[model samples]
Target: MALIGRILFVALFLGSGFAHITQAEAMGGYAASKGVPQAKLATFASGVLIVIGALMVLLGIWLDLGALLLVIFLLPTAFLMHAFWKETDPQAKQLEMIQFQKDLALAGGALLIFALYSGYGDNLGITITGPLF
Candidate 1:
């Protein structure tokens, strides 16, 4: 079920990454509202990162690098985009907290995947080029 697991894991990212690019103007506006600097460019760049990372993981090539890219995107996004602590409204705070927690969890999953591929060697999937490490 390794392939199935990988597919499930990347599902969220593929859709989100596509949206970030295809709807950059709208997503950028949302990012701007959240105080992201250079929102449009950042949104586009983030989309690229997400898509590339997702593809790498899905294809079982350079898995470690793919996981790292995901971690890189997720951590800061959790802090910046979903700053629950900054939300004064109870409902808004709750929503942000959920999003923040989700991001953290996803980041953790990515790290776990990285550790598995990097430590155990690329025996987990198709492994086109193998882990970069």
Candidate 2:
């Protein structure tokens, strides 16, 4: 059970991180479309943050730090990309708000995981006995 949970956590984080890296250009364009200042910079920063976050998550060394970084990175993304100046159409605005809330939830989850288990240990266990004398 624990192993499965750990694997799920790692997979989730790794996938999210990879998305940022793989879609940096698209992300940048989207940011620019949203009227964000320095869209290119935002895109590059996203890629870097995602890569670092993915590494930490996969390596399980300093995952807390990675998760925290993810939270920081995602907060603005959630707001600027999904929340800010919602669509005029009520339905569209509601949809955007829903997406924004989802992103916020994801960010909060990452933060919680980081805070709870950052450096204590992996969510899994691997033990080996000492050689017999």
Candidate 3:
């Protein structure tokens, strides 16, 4: 189970990183649409961030560092892309805000994993005493 969990975690991060890399241009356009300046730069930074974060998470090297980076990256994503801006229509703003909350939740999960496993073994101390009778 621990092995499966770790593999899943690695796969998730890698997939997300690849998405950022592959879709950077589209992401930049979206950022521009949302009023972020230097949208291309922002997209490039985001791609780098995702790739580095995914690598750290997969390698389990400085998990806290990866978690912190992810948190920082998500902040702008949530605020700039998902904020309930006055310019946004009510319904769209509501939807975006919800998505922002979800992103925050994912960030929180990463933080939790970092907190729990940053200094622990590869399995993060998951254990089972015995199988059910």
Backbone collision count in every prediction? 0, 0, 0
Expressed as tens digits, the lDDT of each residue in 1-133 for candidate 1 is: 7778889999999999999989999999999999999999999999999999999999888888998999999999999999999999999999999999999999999999999998865677767777788
Residues 87-127, model 3: lDDT tens digits: 45889878987979977887787677667665454556332
Q: State the C-alpha lDDT per candidate.
A: 0.92, 0.66, 0.68
Flag the better candidate by lDDT, 2 or 3. 3
Q: What stretches of model 3 exceed 4 Å from their correct place?
A: 1-3, 9-12, 85-88, 119-133
The candidate scoring highest on TM-score is 1
If both were scored by lDDT, which would come out higher, candidate 1 or candidate 3?
1
Q: Candidate 3 lDDT (Cα, whole model)? A: 0.68
Sorted on lDDT, best first, the list reads 1, 3, 2
lDDT score at residue 89, model 1, on the 0-100 scale? 100
Which residue pairs show backbone clashes in model 3? none
Which scores greater on lDDT, model 1 or model 2? 1
Off by over 4 Å in 2: 1-3, 10-13, 118-133
lDDT by residue (10-116, candidate 2, tens digit) is: 57556666766677677778889888888877777776786686566545556667667778877887888886356888887888888799878878777765755
As a whole number from 0 to 100, the lDDT of residue 45 in candidate 2 is 71
For model 3 the TM-score comes to 0.75
